[model samples]
Target: MKQTPNVIVIEDNDDDFEALKFAFEEDGAPGLDIERCTTGPEAEHALDRLRDRAEISREDRVLIILDLRLPGLSGFDLLKTMRHDSRLRRIPVVILSSSSNQSDAIESYTAGANAYIRKPRNFDEYVDMVGSFRTFWTGCAELPVLG
Candidate 1:
């Protein structure tokens, strides 16, 4: 059986998280195992635990959606740390932030982000964005096996 894709969303805003959840549901991809981390440190600890898992299947896939403006450590700091870590480096990290600065996007890619997406302004846009994200990341992209 194909395992459900695991998605770790590191976002500090509750409203954005709720909107994302609603969008995923609207996209009809309820099979995704989505987890939320309110701060960068929380996500870092969670990723560390996931990386330390004893056994992982070849089909296991994990994705991280990070926000640039976070409470502790900052998203850029976390991205830099993840790139340096052998195990975490394999997991794909996407930046989903409200920032529209060109410098932020450039920095995100330079720091090791797989993709950088700006947050949608409306609920309909959110749904469309989530749908596209689901179709690409889960259906089309070949995710790295995680342990």
Candidate 2:
């Protein structure tokens, strides 16, 4: 497992993104490097850059929190692209969506998402969720060493 992986958040909603940022700060997420991407293209570019640099610098281990809906390309589409790209395929992608649809969850898993997490209804729950995620992903779990 890698020491600490960078986190890439692909979300379009301003409020949700703010809440996630606050949660990260409040929970004292350890060793987390966050990169925000509001659009699919932006995320793709970010991923490309990350992959390129990782290949050269041996910096691997990336986690992506993606929303289902977006202005341009959808999160599912991005997931597919990542899965198809060998440089990006191993990065853990967790779908953080407001939709609790079974089909959506199935589709995300089918598209090669590492996990599917439904967005909490309120800020408190969001904070709790963040805490749990940090505790597990950052503190306990042995993340993949993409390098």
Show pairs that collide, candidate 2: none
Q: Provide backbone clash counts, one per model.
A: 0, 0
Error of 2 at 18 (Å): 0.4
**Predicted candidate 1 versus true structure: per-residue lDDT over 19-76, tens digit per residue:** 9989999999967889999997898888877777515555668899999999987999
Poorly placed runs, candidate 1 (over 4 Å):
1-3, 54-57
Worst 10 residues of 2 by lDDT: 53-62
Ten contiguous residues minimizing lDDT sum, candidate 1? 51-60
lDDT of 1: 0.88
lDDT value, candidate 2, whole model: 0.87
Tens-place lDDT digits, model 2, residues 4-80: 77889999999999999899988887668888999988988987897786677664677889999987889999999
